[model samples]
Target: MPRSLRARKLENAVGLAVIVALAIASVLPLIHILYMVIVRGVEAIARIGLYRFLTEPPHPFDPQNPGGIGPALVGSLELSGLAIAVATLIALPASVLIAEFRGSRISRGTLLLALTLVEFPTILVGLTVYAVLVDHVVGGYNMLAGAVALTLVILPYMAVQASEALRGVPEGVREAAYSLGATRLKTVYALIAPAARRGILVGILIGLARAAGETAPLLFTVGGAYEGYHLCLYKVGGAVPLMIYQFIQMPYKPAQDLAWGAALVLMTIIVGVMLLARLLVKEVKIL
Candidate 1:
């Protein structure tokens, strides 16, 4: 082989090694965290019994046992579902518009706006919801308010993710569609959206995962209940993150155990969603 070709190969090999090394370094902390949570939490849950730990309402500190976190589990699912639904409604349209008009001033502005909103603090989102819905519009803190707050928090994420997915569609595909006398809307719905569905789903799941784990936003909006489960959207709600936070702060051992268990459950949920995203990402290599 030529000396120049050998030199280029060596350079490429070095770059690949550096990338692999950095990737491993980045993943090390996450692996450590997952291991720690699983070890601590699994032990606690083993002693507690899986059924009671998952189904019953939390019990006050007892050296003998701590109760379940069913109410918080319900609230977290409901809030995250509602938030995903609402965010998807707004985000899909915005993303579609941006994809269609990639060079438009409005699209540029919208992209910038979404990027800005993604950086907005979760506390601020909660406060905004509290001010607008709790005190002013709805006259109370309810699941509705909590869901709305989460929607604001995840809207940008969905918008940007969907847009990137849409952008990944080959330009030639759009041109081909145009050649077939397809309208812009027809092209988007029939061709672009299908090609990007997996990516969009990934974003949706990620947004839901983040929203579910949010404690700060729920602090001001949900103000979780311990007495009983609240099912109505207009009623107060509790979430797993809030339950975990409250439990972990107690001076009681049982409560601490419950906290660990709850953390494990929450982490399991987020990790599950992430794994689903990874599956979709692998299946759809458009980007």
Candidate 2:
């Protein structure tokens, strides 16, 4: 090889090696976490039975107690579902408006605000929600309050991703729609939205996972409960993150074991969303 070509190839090889090394390093911690959770959690689930765990409330911090995380699981699901619904209502339209009206000042300002919101800390979000909805508006911490806080926490990231996805929709396709006498609304909803469905699906899953895993916002908005079945929007709610946090802090073997199980459940939920998204994408592609 010529000297220049040889030098370029060596540089490319070095860059590739560095990237591969970094990627492996990044994944190692995640793998370790998964390993630890599985090793400690699977036994608890097996001993307790999945159905029981999904239907019964937790027991006292006794190693011999057969407590389940049913309420916590339900709360987490309700909270995440509410956040997903509200966030989608706001984020999807906001994303399209930002992309469709990229030249307008309102669009520019809205997009900039969205990017800014993504950087806002979850803890701060919790505090704000607590002060407004919990302390003032509703007069106490409640499930709806937590759901609203989570929506605030997850909406920006989802909106930003959705906006990028809409932006990637081919301009030519939109122009063609316009030429065919389609209204702007039709082009945005029928054409651009469908074209960017996969990216929007990713945004939805990301928001759902983030909201489900968050403990701080729940701490402020929805205080934990014990041995009860309450999925009310206006009542204090149980959540897996709150359970795990409370359990891990106690100086008891049973609580610790329960924490591990709860962690596994939470991880499974987030992972399941990704798996579901993949299945959805596959179905859409097939159609």
lDDT of each: 0.86, 0.86
Stretches of candidate 1 exceeding 4 Å from the true structure: 1-28, 282-287
TM-score of each: 0.87, 0.88
lDDT of 2 at 70: 86
What's the true lDDT of residue 210 in model 1? 90
lDDT of 1 by residue, 11-67 (tens): 999999999999999999999999989998998888868887887877757777577
**Total clashing pairs for each candidate:** 0, 0
Off by over 4 Å in 2: 1-23, 278-287
lDDT of 2 by residue, 67-97 (tens): 8888899888899999999999999999988
Instruction: Report RMSD for candidate 2.
Output: 4.1
Error of model 2, residue 135, in angstroms: 0.6
lDDT value, residue 272 of candidate 2: 89
| Candidate 1 colliding pairs | none
